[model samples]
Target: MTPPMTPVCAKPRRRRLAALTALAAVFAVLATACTGGGGTAAQDVQDSYKTLPKESGKPTDGGTATVALTPGLSPNYIYPYPPASANGTVIARGLMWRSLYRPSGEGDQIADTALSLAEAPAYSSDRKTVTIKMKDYSWSNGRPVTADDVVFSLDLLKAALKESPANWSFYTPGQFPDGVTAKATTPDTLTLELDTAYNPSYLLSMLTLLYVMPSEEWNIARTGGPHLDHSDPENAKAIYTYLTKQSESQSTFADNPLWQVVNGPYRLKSFDPTTGSFSLAPNKEYSGPGDSRLDQVDFKSFTSAAAVLNQFKAGKLTVGTLDSSFITQIDALKKQGYHVYGAPAPARFDPLVLNFENTTNNFDKVIARPYVRQALQHLIDQGGYVKSRGVYNGAASPNYSTAGSGSPYPPEFGDQAPYPYDPAAAEKLLTDNGWKVVPDGSTTCERPGTGPGECGAGIPQGQTIDFTLSSANTPAYVGARDIAFASQAKKLGVEVTIETKSLNYLYTNYGNSFAPANKDKWAAQDYGPLYLAAGYPSSNTVFNTGGSFNLGGYRNAEVDKLIEASTFGADPTVLSTEVTSLSKDLPVLFFPTPHTLVVWKDTLSGPPSSFNALLSFLYTPELWYFREQDS
Candidate 1:
């Protein structure tokens, strides 16, 4: 049986909203929320070009930096590939094991060549064969990271897929690592032969997720056993089984010798099981770029956003994130000697996932119509939400496309919303398409025909426009928007009942594919945000027909062709084309993209690029250091 699914919560800004404990301060933030973004209140989603000021005085070594992890997203597993229930692998994966390619912090680029394990790939004339040259990096055991290790990692990943696809959420059957075969041409080179040619950009994006493991020390099936040929399928399976079993024993994570073989800048030093907090020490054998001046790095976790705010107020944290709920405390934080910066996370979009497979009340047929989806999209007041005191409080950006706001691959429609929030337009579109307009009352289909100005086929004449929207409970903005949407829908004679559920519960039981019995139980779900590959944000397994992650059973032949072209074809512009089509079609309802607000003490400093990585869900604590002797 397949295990329960766990959605990756990338953006910490929307992690959890604090209770309104301070009524006066909440109103103050709302008053200044409209500082900019006139007319539509749709502020530009582009990143701030202003670089953070460098720390004053000489840099000191051997100091500790206490970094705050996302609230409730504490790390529990040491393995690179974690199970669905794994809490915070995104933080652990990047810091413990380095991927083959480093995800670019910027939105336009696919990979960061400067920090990657391998140089840029050289494609063959036919574009089916590719060669990768490994950089000068070493494992914690003082062994050189070799091409054989990359191939060994691939073999084990294949074994994991054979055991269960749920082991890796990104794995879609027959795509990536399925038709691809790897061979170590030399100690410094690894070559891959692909069954079909793929767009170089798409291929690089996939490589960003492949974390390399130490083959020399990790090739055995059991502790102190003789090394086995990891290329062999059976031996690879045995080794994977051993490592996976070891990962489940969280108590031994810091003590296990297998877990300490690190290629990245840090190695596991200690772990707190009860609180899910962990500490890392600099790897003496780490051969990657950047200086490891800090003696230790600690990742602290919290149960609520209010707890995090209290820590910030007490000046207890060195570097951490400030939830938008505490935007009113910005001036206070600045007075307390902290720097605050924020922007929309790259390749991140907040969408209201619609269930086209839900056939309850003829919703399948009613939602199949283009005008209905467009009308529903108009009901989402993105601007109002950002400015509202109860919602984002202007710490968010208005996004209209899947490519996300301020994306390099913006649709032809650009920032201009194809379906802006217009109540009259929505009502007119419904009435023009043969639905009786009833403001604040029940609206039903009056004309039932497939022709123009008629409710499409399978929709009965008396069918009502009604559906239940299941919203995530923690992220206060999600519930706020759901209520606003339901109220807007009510004005148009549409009944949208709101139901709240935890994020974990929704991920486990709300999916149409996993819970077939509950297909008709939900019509829509707002799970906040979905993060894609850093730079190349392709919607292959998201909107494509029969996609593994296609929870709502959305199907469109044109979208399928467009996604294929972007995945296999060389032209990068095809991605914009695909997003343009989806924007007009409204595969999923779009919402405002939340800004990732990062807060840190003025004494703590690092390269400006280190702060940029926070937006992409990657951390570079190895380069961070204290500026003054007493910091």
Candidate 2:
């Protein structure tokens, strides 16, 4: 339920994880060039981890590092919890207010205890009661981050949900804060009593989204007013209203007193609304891991990937991502004194979201049929798409299920394509289902009935398989793959009309939950990958019935039960079973998981793990510093 990442521009609302900076990984190395570290980089290009030079030299004093924000995806909201239509990155959240549990960059680990604000939760035997102890952390205002702050944050979150479910995308009507009672039993101890027992892993995953705010500072309903107890429901609601209203005044973000009192590694120094660029200075009061040696970190935004690449070529960008379409430039970028690395981001998947509520061209009825969905899935050439130079350029791996490659909870099919690309198979499935066999022309339903070998209910004779694909306008590969799919569908007599839209536009207007009026406007959308929590890949809010982020109104009784089992049941294997069912159900059209190619200046050195976090679209600039020589 983390923030869903569009391949290029725009990061849609808050969910479980933070904003995705870019796009995935298959470890194949492209050729490497000499680096500023005075070493020949790994040459095979197939080894994903060995491409970057080893960390060298001693840490130096104050230096400013420029980070490239994903093209078109820049921070616009300072609040941790954002509304459904909240377009733009929420990167400022992690930079200022630290989440209770820090997400691990490693695939095998769930949380990074060294960076987390709370110790791991201790669950009662019945599993309905949980206790969490706050770490020794302080806010910029010199106040201890107490358990009362945690309770206050939860209260405000509940208030946001009470106002409207859309205010917080991760919310379900009766889940988490809805039925749980949070208590600050001691200054550092916060306890929770749940109505229903939840899987420990699942509950911990939920805590990753709970960011601790300074209750002492943010408890008031008005600026320059007396601080009220946020534990009161009405007071919490008023405080939420006030904070959200203040968050909308983006012009005052840098100067706002509410925002300056941060608890994370860095504090906002300036924000440019015009360019969506911003700068950060290390918080002297930060009490977390690593030395905040870097004096400043500047985030740069661009209108297109081309502009980012131009900056990289000119050695203007210190840290950023390179588009897969420009894969050929890897060696040249290495020679430009940049360290380039690529990997499939953990717990991430890209799909063409199918809007089942869209009645346009009767697509809802057409796509409802399992055979038809399978046929359409067949039209996608996952392998060819990965191999295509204009597509992923050998930087992506073919993924057939929601449980992406190397998942801890892989489906039964496990990397094998359930519906491998075959135009003949697509045609055969349609023809067997009473569709007229028309090559390169409009095919219609020859037999319309609710019986075997016939078009399903609500579909009539002469019904054509036609729909519009709303494609994102960044990361170029999105359009390339859509065109390829359309061409394949064309050969099968299915018409897929392509319409391009900006990622920002798609993030804001394409979701059925927020923009139900526009449901029929788009049959399908291909914005990009949706990143869940890396260690625990739960589809709670993404695929479950009535999920806030469920852009497509996809519903299935068995799927709902499976999702429920994964959420509340203690059996870890249930996640595999759930994803397996989702894979076969074809709720959304699965696309190849593209490897995000992360490029950074070689002179900027830190623990290699810090750079590795970039592959997952995570920023830990606090751990980074300039080498002594470079500084």
Best by TM-score: 2
TM-score of each: 0.90, 0.93
At residue 438, candidate 2 shows an lDDT of 82
Q: What lDDT does each candidate get? A: 0.79, 0.81
Q: List candidate 2 segments past 4 Å from native.
A: 6-53, 85-88
Error (Å) of candidate 2 at residue 73 is 1.4
Worst 10 residues of 2 by lDDT: 27-36
TM-score of 2: 0.93
lDDT of 2: 0.81
lDDT of 2 by residue, 1-631 (tens): 3444422125433221211112111111211110112243322344642365678888887889988887767678887776554554564687789989987777666677788999999999999999999999999977888998898899999988888887776777788778889999999999999999998888887887888898999988888988988878999989998988888888999999999989999999999977789999988899998788999999998878999999998878789998887877888988888888888878888889999999988999999998889999998888767766556767788898786667788898776788988778988899999899787899999999999899889999999999999877677778777777877788788999877776777877888876799999999999877887777787888788888778898999899999899899988689988888998889899889888888988888888878877877678888888887742
Residue 413 alpha-carbon offset, candidate 2, angstroms: 1.5
All candidates: CA RMSD (Å): 4.5, 6.4
